[model samples]
Target: MRAYMQGGGFVVEVDPDEIEAFSSRWPCSNLTVTSGKEFLFSAENGDILDAATVSRGRRFSTEADDGSALAALADDACRFGAQALSLTDVLAIRFPDLAQAAPRP
Candidate 1:
């Protein structure tokens, strides 16, 4: 599994099992999985700001693939009261084990 976000221009790939475990443990209400290819993270108003798309192997993409769509969405969401969270903060919250193991500057 992979999580991609343009906010930090990062793509984090982990085992599928780990992703499943995290999903089950946290169960984010704003996350939507569709057809096993797309994962959308929406704002409180249901506007998708971040997204991930699984391709072949451990590779994945994000809403940033469509030019500045991800940025536009993020901006719109923020305008409508969505608080911005950095990719690091998001990863730290969603994958505490991995985040803790990573080197920090």
Candidate 2:
């Protein structure tokens, strides 16, 4: 299963079972897993940690305006045999020259 975080700059791939397990561990704030199809994670202040969509063998897509926080959550999700890749990393690989052209500070 592949979960894509909209505007979060990363995606996590994990089995559907792992996604269910993760959702079970975290409570949803606004949505319910009626069909075991959606999951939402929010902070105490109401900021979203992650949001995901679950399917036959895939689950959850988390999104947040804060890229750093989203990345951290994605990292945590990886503990369940999930693999994550950042969009920045993909861009660097796809456009090496551009990636290396940035001025060093």
- What is each predicted model's overall lDDT from 0 to 1? 0.38, 0.38
RMSD of each: 11.5, 11.2
Candidate 2 lDDT by residue in tens digits, 1-105: 454554433344444454456556555423233323332222111123445654565664543222443333344543211122323333344434444543333
TM-score of each candidate structure, all chains considered together: 0.26, 0.26
Candidate 2, lDDT over the whole model: 0.38
Could you say which candidate leads in lDDT?
Answer: 2
Off by over 4 Å in 2: 1-12, 29-73, 78-105
Clashing pairs in 1: none
